[model samples]
Target: MQQDAVIIGGGFAGLSAAYILARARRHVTIIDSGTPRNRFAAHSHGVLALDGKSGLEILADARAQLAAYPTVTFLNGEAHAAQGTIDDFHVDVAGHEPITTRRLLLSGGIEDRLPDIPGLTERWGKTVLHCPYCHGYEIGGGPIGVLSTQPMSAHQAAVVADWGDVTLFTNGMPEPDEETLALLERRKVSLQPGTVDVIEAGTCDRLRVRLKNGRTFDVKALFVAADLHRRGTIAESLGCTLTETPAGMIIATDTVKATSVAGVYAAGDNARAFGNITLVSADGVMAGLGMHQSLMFSGHS
Candidate 1:
């Protein structure tokens, strides 16, 4: 009826926290809504030791390994609301009984908001992608395109240029600064100053970009630095302050992953500016260890 921690997600962050807490002989329950941000990504890369595997495969392996721990439970449900202080938290999941825990870890991750280009959404995570570290190697040395949605899109294009021939499409956004323009010219990255109407991809993996000015460019991959937002509404309800990053405003937490709200912690994409899988997992470990130490110091264990 009682648990040491309730993790409100099932992604790399929540799984890592639950695994660590369970190993410490703590009762931990992870409530997930069965949707991860990387679901659309066919293969997950850049994570050490498990590179180039499907996101589902990595999660399945993690779940299988965590099943051996007796203190961990996975609930296929969403945490609708949370109540009580840190030492005593009550979580309500839709269509399920409420769960009580001594601490709460929120790793609900974020949602990526892509541009309104006609075919870009459909090709997301496959032909139209983000994060060079995650998908760059797979599409390396190929003709790549970067769709400009924000000011940072130029920077993303510059970094991704190292892996392929780069093209920057200003999708109704302003032009870059003099320095940026010079860099693009020096790097031989073409700049298309027009709105993108759609992205066309064939079954054979050929990708094409159609511009509003009746221009089309051939490319194998497209990089979009989409906007990000928290997937859950619980953080704001709990009065957790958010700090703005290049992607979005993530829940502000200290080095140990403790949020402003005492007794509640955050990890993964929800708490970190750079929300890579490896970084998120490390944040979860730190939060879990910190929670355990707090419990031990309070003589709660």
Candidate 2:
């Protein structure tokens, strides 16, 4: 019977929960795999007081603050397998001992499948961005390109046009409905219909997208809704119910981040339908309190 609250992911949401739990004098152990979904992003924006800080810097600062709480422990490894139930979960860490805890926080995160375009991976988080609100201001009203991956790209083009010159590139994505196309036209978003052949790095950290039809557009940034895939088999291994959305299947959690399975909680990207750093960090706070209360009341069971 272990007493520590185990947080399996150590990203923003993961760390946020750990700090709150530790402050309450609850023993916490955060096991981080060190593989971040946002490792590609140079700076994490829209976070108060932490804007423009690299993802690495933000995590380092978070871990530093948690150090003040002696009960919080940090381990580096992946969750190869997990067993047991809430308030009594066992997590096996590769190259380390198994962690058995009183409560589990599954925030391992989601993976982004960017379009298979050359030069896009390198420029990601720098020039090739995803959320307009995240990286739009940095582009500063310049030429922007939106690679249509889902039907939402039409809406993305219409919304992003406010930031700068926006071009809707439908690289063989599903054709938008007539109403959506009409809305995009009204927004003054230029439409290009062709498969992107190659994306090359350009001067001044710009991007050059060449099409199969021998067309090109050099833009300051590229926006995409990369198909998201959940990381690891933690949710599945825990017998947690998942919900399906346009994006992908995600661990379904209630208002306080309680999943369908009891004694198991989730926060951050893997738990939410949509999320940003600020939003997920808030989720972590709620989850931290929720787990603490559950532990305090479990003796009544």
Candidate 3:
């Protein structure tokens, strides 16, 4: 049977959409490779009641709850390709038969491309992070390092000062203009113009930021605005409009999460340049409602 909707991800956004669809008795299939963007983090914050739960744990709970719905189905695999439009979408999985659905939802999330620095990868999502709102509170105020990845680093450095004594590591980037320097000075952000050499764990839950010039600064945590890229090509394959945001490219969608291509929706990080659990979860809810309304009015299924 052709599914009413096929959500091509199983993270927070995908699962949340699935929950809503299943509640409405829509036959939905979720195809996911199981590699969520926030899998590296041990805990999730800024969520309503589920704060402090690990992201994986949240997914686990969501999956378990979704299992209670007979209309929801899970497929643990990569969606290799996608085609067709509107009420007749086709998705190809890596190891399974192709799926036909009346609607498609792309929530595959994004991939963070960290800089080529030794020890940075291992520390990411732990001591190294991106958004201050998501992980800043637990950092216990002061001694936070911002590793410059893009021009936005200066702004990030200034903002993070609210959570800690901020250090903006220019890391070979151009020096901030006088106005920006003055802003940083007002924010009490320290500027380090040296290029980064390496990052390593320091004593007592701190990170050691070592510069190429042999200068080292120890901090409770490090922040970086890593370059983000969409994880899957299904949205592109289906010719959905993509928007370029300050964070990166994302699937462009309407307020209700409907992509440019009718009957195809997107939510979560794939649809948003910057996102957190709450925002992406709401994206899923909107997409679910929008798809359901489309189905009901258009009589697709």
Candidate 4:
């Protein structure tokens, strides 16, 4: 028997899509690795009514709401490979039975690789973060630090300047050109050079950044850019085109969320560059509708 849809992730996007499809009387299966990109964040901000809720808390609520729908199935494992075609696809998932579905939705999400700086990874999603809109307000008016990893970091520092006293660290990257320097100086943002050697926690939520040049600075928090990539190969294995964006690369999809391959849809970070809770959830909704519309008219086409 074939499911009406098999969503290859059960994060906010995948779960939201399943709810829509299940409500439409379609049998939906959500295959997730049970680990999401934001799992490391103690709490997520700027996320609608759920703002400030722990990542785990938000997911628990989503899963609980989805439980009422008997048509939606969940498998806690990773998807291995995919074969066959639209309206008759075979999917292999490790440690789970194989699946057949009329439509496939890839919401497998993405991974963020921060620099291997000592203690940097441990502080990420806590004292270290990105996106002022998502986390800046919570930080309030305090000392904030921006670690430069890319050429555009000065721009990032200027943006984060509104949150607090901003310090831009070149961190072994290029010194800010005169143009960028003038802007940060105008904003009263401090600039530091040399690579970040270590990050250490201090009392009262303060962070200490040490440089190879033997310079040290303390601030309430630090921000570093991370490279984002698709978490798995299911999308590429099934032949979804990839595209680059300002934030990161994403799986390419049409407006309705259909990929280049028929009956295959993509949502969440896998399909779009900029994403948050509200945005990615809507991405899944579009994929759900796209899948349904295609199946509804398949008899005639």
Predictions in order: lDDT: 0.86, 0.86, 0.91, 0.85
| Tens digit per residue, CA lDDT, model 1, 96-213 | 9999989899998577888777888988898888888888887858788999988988888888888899999988889999998888887778888988888886445778888888
- Global lDDT for candidate 3? 0.91
Which pairs of residues collide in candidate 3? 142-164, 142-165
lDDT of 4 by residue, 190-233 (tens): 88778889998866778998888888888888987777777667
lDDT of 3 at 299: 56
lDDT of 2: 0.86
- Name the candidate that leads on lDDT: 3
- Pairs that collide in candidate 2 are none
- On a 0 to 1 TM-score scale, where does candidate 1 land against the true structure? 0.96
Clashes of 2: 0
Name the runs in model 2 displaced over 4 angstroms.
203-205
Reference-based TM-score of each model? 0.96, 0.96, 0.97, 0.94
Segments in model 4 whose C-alpha atoms lie over 4 Å from true places: 176-179
TM-score of 2: 0.96
Give per-candidate clash totals: 0, 0, 2, 0
Clash total of candidate 1? 0
